[model samples]
Target: MQAYKLAEQALVGKRNADTVALAMYFVPQPVSRKDGFRRTVNIKANPMGFATGSNLNFDLGLPKLMAKAKPVFCEAFRLEGHYESKSGYPTTVSVQSDSDGDFKVVSMQRLFPNVSQDSLQQLHGELAQQYASAIKAGIAKLEMKTPRVELRFMHPIMIQGAGAGSDEASKLFQAHWQQGWMEFKGKNIGLLGAMKTVADHNKNSVPACKPQVLTLN
Candidate 1:
């Protein structure tokens, strides 16, 4: 149920929840009495009586849920809102049609070319070991795309459907991912690690990390 709602919200965002911000959905727990299971008596209903979904608190936990569900972009150029990479957030993201009503997300790109949810779940489980800080702060939304076209022999796709087979397509995708929280975990020192250097620096002490220079040869 939680996963369903998470995916649902990735598409609809705050639109539907806004309509039900005032309601509350109660999942009453069972308690053991001196005889058997005890239940509640007549709970007061709203003045309008029970609507189909009038008892749910759709406005709850949106932030944490969104933070957990990464933004997925399967196709290029589907981004309807601005992605803020440096800041780790998105703005005005496009939503699927309201008529579908199940609240499923089909356009959000939050994974890489071959990455799977199972792999992510495993990686997330390991967060407590080496990436404890990321686990505590939450893993940044990931981007696992080619990000651009290379002139290698195995290449087969075009740059955003353009004939140009350079790094332009990857750069464009990076621009979109950059608009949100793009996670870099494998190597290259990464943007987050670089930024942390400034935070970890001091005038009086030695640096915790050394400089690394990278070049694409």
Candidate 2:
């Protein structure tokens, strides 16, 4: 399956999660021409999408991956809630937020036209209602529990092909320790545990997974 499809599936059932990644970039808009006609003017948009940020760099492929997945995820969320694309291209969706600035539902729209607008809009309304109902249930769950901090390991490394005569064994060992320090500095919970879980999920085959610590403050 395509990476975008995989991301969409992963995001389908998420609730109260900030699924949208925000970045900064410029957008071109039509302005008055010098001869009293019209011209295109470039203006900076606030909290630009990942694609725009990546566009500024020639060597980076991050934006390309993000661009591909943006629409798939947008449609998936639209099936659950409201999304308003402020700028037509590099679509940016404004999600409704509660008075406390918490999102009631995930908000985003596709930048490309690969999906039908009507289908996406209809899905958005349906998803929004479902999200609202889920929020109520979530509130009840939270009220029943004492708030506490919990951590889980997200990524771990494994030693492979380590031997006395291996050409790069010592270098690999050094790199592992260096990475371990970086992961430890982030105060990640179950860093090792998460790695083990993922390793087992991948059938003990080593896959490179970048660990990021998500802190709820």
Candidate 3:
């Protein structure tokens, strides 16, 4: 029994190593704020997904393993959310990886895409309706039926990797941490825990198995 349990744990670790990962340049957009409590919503739209099946050159993007973001729907359930572009950039936002080791900036680019004012106006109109519809329905998720017409025009910055070594990657990550630049949705979670949550979602196909507040201690 002991040997079997050990083997099982190792197997689980291996599976997570491949399926879980981190995002750079952009992260998940959590909608629905509260007075006190906070909830992380895993939406169904990511940069890679938007780029994929389209002519958009977001190849600096770490390709999303799945074709579509699967927001787990619930009636009493909170909203399923995904990532959105917060900043397009000449900044240091990078796609971090740890398959072989920790703190590797897998890819990045100097400049991210910038949206045009006309497109922003269009986005404002679409997003206004999008949020209003969700709020009116008393849910916190974007409806799939509605087209995200705005994104087609709003181009985000490109991220290209420089092929840094593990040590250099670790140093870069450390600098970000010291500067308080890195953020994880869960209060006490970090990169590894976040990926573990991703793996859990991949393994379990139920709402109960979703990634919630996690603490690494």
Candidate that would win on TM-score: 3
lDDT digits (tens) for residues 1-217 of candidate 1: 4433433333333335422321121222122221121212222343333333211222224333434442221111111222333543222223221111112221222222123656545544443354333222222223222321111110111112222233543343334333332233123353334234323442123222223458888
Model 1 segments more than 4 A misplaced? 1-165, 185-217
Ranking of all candidate structures by their lDDT, best first = 3, 2, 1
List the candidates' TM-scores in order: 0.17, 0.18, 0.19
Top-lDDT structure, candidate number? 3
Q: Which runs of model 2 end up more than 4 angstroms from their true locations?
A: 12-59, 63-175, 180-196, 199-217
Count of steric clashes across candidates, in order: 19, 13, 14
Query: What RMSD does each model have against the real structure?
Result: 22.0, 22.6, 19.6
Model 2 agreement with the true structure over 1-217: per-residue lDDT tens digits? 2433334333443322223221211122223322221222233342232122111111123245345433122211111111223643232222221222122222222322215556545544554454442222221011111121111111112222222233343333334333332333223333344334433443323122223469998
> In model 3, where do residues sit more than 4 Å from their true spots?
1-113, 137-217
Cα deviation at 8, candidate 1, in Å, is 20
* lDDT against the true structure, each candidate: 0.28, 0.28, 0.30
